[model samples]
Target: MNRGLYEADHEAFRDTAREFVIREVLPHLDRWEEARLIDRGVWVAAGTQGILGLSGPSDFGGADQLSDYRFRNVLLEELAEVHATSLSSGFSLQDDIAIPYVAALGSDEQKARWLPGMCSGELIGAIAMTEPGTGSDLQGITTSARPTGDGWVVNGAKTFITNGIQSDVVIVVVRTDPGGGRDAFSLLVVEEDMPGFSRGRKLEKIGLHAQDTAELFFDDVVVPHENLLGELGAGMHQLATHLPRERLSIAAHAVASTRVVLRETLEYTRTRRAFGRRLADFQNTQFVLAELATRLDVTQAYVDASIHALNAGELTAVDAAKAKWWATDVQNQIVDACLQLHGGYGYMTEYPVARAFQDARVQRIFGGANEIMKHIIARDLVDRPDR
Candidate 1:
């Protein structure tokens, strides 16, 4: 399982990322979870460490490692080692989703205004796509922005938004045309203090307590025409183009988490005794661990290859769906089995396995539900025009 996925530079970056997590993440994780929010200070610290804006150009204060995703993968693995998944998810949102979208779609002025601060972690960003009623169906979005004197009046609500509570810049997806169609939607950048832009309560969830998730409301908020991201009527295309990277990032997290839980389980089984023998001595435990290890290795290979494909700009949306669904499925399965092996202790929130079990469930649901992933894959296999 050498994988050979990382180069010397990636390993060097890992050292830096690992040190940061140990210093900034591990000690505060419990307190963050208790408060139901991470302190903004951690975001600044990560920016200073060059971990927040890997995708931005060096001129924007980023590390300029966007094309090589291996560095991001390295950071994820290091975070997974300590079971700091909530923080991992938050950072992933910055590096993988929000930053990339702005970098790809923002005009020069937009980039100059936003990229440097985003790289510095002084500015937090979130993409608001899921409405109160819409999840995967982008066409169903009812949040509409109508043209007005000098700007557009935006009205809508978005729920289940990551970084919603803390985001300084939000790329809000709104319908430019009342009539629903592909050409109807557009992206408007809404700033923090915009009138009628408000955040609802921070949502409580089964897991990811340390990461902020909230409901956002926009009622009659006037967004400048200059704040528009990309072309009008191109929000759908922009979202589709960027979704593969989000899915791949999720796959990477799933694989790294699976490896961590499996490793911990192995160590637990070898040390803990039951019925006058170590748990590892039991035939049942041995078979279970054997199966889990094999599955992890197999899944890791696909994710690794997917990472390479992503770096080469060859990872298709369909392939990303495959990696996302399969890797997360394996991750959840392995974590559940590992938890069961821990007996009652696994049910305790203090145990990382228990926390991982809760955290792993959302992977299959977010970044497009695994069922949606299957639909995408199935459509490719059965509904192609070539067929």
Candidate 2:
């Protein structure tokens, strides 16, 4: 399968991204994993390379690549090649989830204040949505923001927040109306220095060791009225509007990562001997690879089409959910099988496949669980009942 997904410009961008990963990311990966955090310098280096704010406004030093998601796909592919799952997830949190909210909904003043720093990677961003009690149920969030004379006082806590520890700015989702309706929630941009805003301990995870996932607490943190993102009482709609892109972004990474594991497994089987014969010479090995390859090609086609659809503004939440769940499920399965093929070596942390296996677990969990994705698809099916 030629894929035929990238043009010359995209290929050129791919080269630049690959070079950046090789130089800036590969060397420090081990140290970062040991420390459970990526160095702040890499973000700055990425910003310097014009990679951080691809979809940001031009006035704020962004390339404004939002319309063309293929550039982001290129970056995802390159990161996957190195099995940099932690780094890839961290970047996606910024580029796909957090930045888009600001770019799309922030006021002109908000844009002027934050976009430049975000684009330059001097200011990291995180979106706090999931609470200790709320996962997919945004309506159930208890984080409250009350209007005050000077500003809004925000009080709540968020868990499983990516970049939580390092984020210079956090877009905190808080309930503004206690009545519990669709219009109750609003997003408040909480800066680092805000009083009563504090970060909990960095969470320990089975994978994504270098990525900072943490719990955030807002205790009477006063966010200025000007810091509200999007219209008040419209948080649910805003989150709904942005979710398709976020899911698609996850799907892109899932497929790219699956391809990396498959490629590496192919090479490993070609040389590694089993029972005095090459692993590739076995019929079972050949059959397994053939099956995996077919699935990869078919899934790649659908994902590519979805990318094009997303760029054209036609990607629906249903479709994005399909891509996200399917690709991530396939990625986990493929990586597990690849690890099986590697036998004992795959279990060793020294091997990329082992780390990939661990990292792939969360794909089905986050960006809304795969189960949630199925619920969305099922709901759509019932609603249409025609197609």
Q: Rate the local accuracy (lDDT) of all candidates.
A: 0.92, 0.92
lDDT value for model 1: 0.92
lDDT of 1 at 292: 96
Off by over 4 Å in 1: 385-387
Q: How does residue 148 of candidate 1 score in lDDT?
A: 95
lDDT of 2 by residue, 208-299 (tens): 88889999999999899899999999999999999999999998999999999999999999999979999999999999999998888888
**Tens-digit lDDT track for model 1 on 98-204?**
88888889888988999999999999988888987899887999998999987899998999999999999998899999986898999899999999999999999
Each candidate structure's TM-score, on Cα atoms with residue i matched to residue i, is 0.98, 0.99
What residue runs in model 2 are displaced by over 4 Å at the alpha carbon?
385-387
